[model samples]
Target: MRVALMITCFNDALFPDTGKAVLTVLRRLGVEVDFPAAQACCAQPMVNTGYLDEAVPVVRNFVRAFEGYDAIVAPSGSCAGSIRHQHGLVARRSGDAGLATAVARLAPRSYEFSEFLVDVLGVEDVGASFPHRVTFHPTCHSLRMLGVGDRPQRLLRKVHGLQLVDLPAAGECCGFGGTFAVKNADTSIAMGADKARRVLETGAEVLVAGDNSCLMHIGGILSRQRAGVRVMHLAEVLASHEGAA
Candidate 1:
């Protein structure tokens, strides 16, 4: 299948290697993946921040940019969730029937990384090796919104030499809801601290998550506390070899 990588705005700027890792893994698995440079934000930020009116153009641009792919895969659950769940709302909020129709035609085809790997590609072992003790964090959108379930864990378990550990209360939110952190700093930090504590308790060298935004949120607390846990994207872990992660 011809797939396009919807590198979310957050990933494009902050976690570039995450995108590269996704590309590497997909290509290695013999999937034709491409990135439409014209693609930008999925408008998740604006919509999540109570700006549906402002998110209309962004939603439009997202649909327009990644228009022709058979599948649009994003390494981020939050962004993929935005496209699947919010685009219709934004189109309706804008009172654009044409846009709404276009979105309905496209949104279902967009999948998060784990969803694509498990549900679409139908393969868990991508011939990857990462000999490290690792724990995974199920981000809010992937867990609650997209309902990705244990697809990520299923894939991670098949990786050679990787010890997958259970995260304490793995379903809990990391509290990095885009603007939620900024609007409620104390609560965000508290939530992040709790997550970091749980991650440290796993005694894993790496703390992995489907969304970099959550990793970024929890990583900060882990870093400040000198938790000695490396934060990584699931794609990075899947793409890791003896050379790079």
Candidate 2:
């Protein structure tokens, strides 16, 4: 199957490792993963921040970039959610019938990492092995927007030597809704503090989530609090094997 990797804006600049890990894991599974050069943000930031008019070009660029690909995949649940759920709204709001149709055509073909791995590819164990006790925080987009129930956890469970611990309030939002963090600093920090406390209570070595933004928000609080826990992207853990130092 031909897969196009849509590296989200955050992942492209901050956490490129997640993108590489996604590529590695997919290639290991014999899937032909392609990186479309024209891909950029799914225009989620503009759309979510009430800048829908400014998001047209970005949406158009995204549609044109991977229009011919068999499937478009991203390592981020948030970006995938944006493409699947928001692109059409932006297009329709701008009164661009052509763009709306293009977005409609492209949205359903996009899949978040775990959704593509378990649902599209039909494989759980990518032969990954990681010797660590880890707890997962289900990002709101993955859980609610995409409704990816337990698919990520199921994949993690099959990893050799990896101990899966239950996270307290795993379904709670990490409070990093992009601009939401900036608009409501106290509320965002409060929510993040709660999530960080849950991570600490789990006593896991690391907190993993599909969305880096959420991980960064909660991880920052844990770091400042000296909580002795590290944050990781789901792809990084899923791509690990015994030989990969």
Candidate 3:
């Protein structure tokens, strides 16, 4: 299958390892992956921040970069959610019918990393090994937007030596709604603190989530408080073969 990595702007800029992990694991499975360098932001930041006019060109760039690929994959559920659910609306608002149709064709073809691995590739275990206690946080986008269900945990369950612990209030948002964290600092931090507290209660050595943005938010709180836990992206965990070192 011909697959392309969207490599969302945030991941490219901050959490590059997640994108690398996706590429590593997919190639290990013998599926050739392409990196479309023209790909950039999914315009989620502009759309979510109420800058609709500014998102048009960004959305156009997305559809243009990913249009011909058989499958477009990203490590981020938030950006994937935007493409699948919100990009069309942005296109319509731009008054470009062609752009709207292109987005329609591309959105459904886009899959978040875990979603692509288990759902599209029809494989659960990617033959990974990580001898550590890990708990998962279901970022709101992956749960509600993408509706990935138990795919993330299901894949993790099959990893060799990886223990998947239940996260308390796993469904709650980690309080990193992009601009939500910036505009509503107190509320965002409070919600993140609660999520961090729950993560600590599990005593897991690592906190895993599909979205790096969410992980970063909770990790900040845990790090400042010296919680002694590692924050990992789901792809990184799945990409582990010999062991996560």
User: Which is better, 2 or 3, measured by TM-score?
Assistant: 3
Residue clash pairs of candidate 3:
none
Model 2's lDDT to the true fold? 0.90
Worst 10 residues of 1 by lDDT: 236-245
> How much is 199 displaced in model 3, in angstroms?
0.5
Which lDDT tens digits does candidate 2 get at residues 158-210? 98888999998888888889999999999999999999999989889988889
lDDT of 1 by residue, 86-164 (tens): 9999999888899999899889999999999999999899888999999999999998889999999999999988999
**Candidate 3 lDDT over residue span 190-211, tens digit each:** 9999999999999999999999
Q: Where is model 3 poorest over a 10-residue stretch in terms of lDDT? A: 236-245
Per-prediction backbone clash count:
0, 0, 0
TM-score of 2: 0.97
TM-score of each: 0.97, 0.97, 0.97
The alpha-carbon lDDT assigned to residue 206 of candidate 3 equals: 97
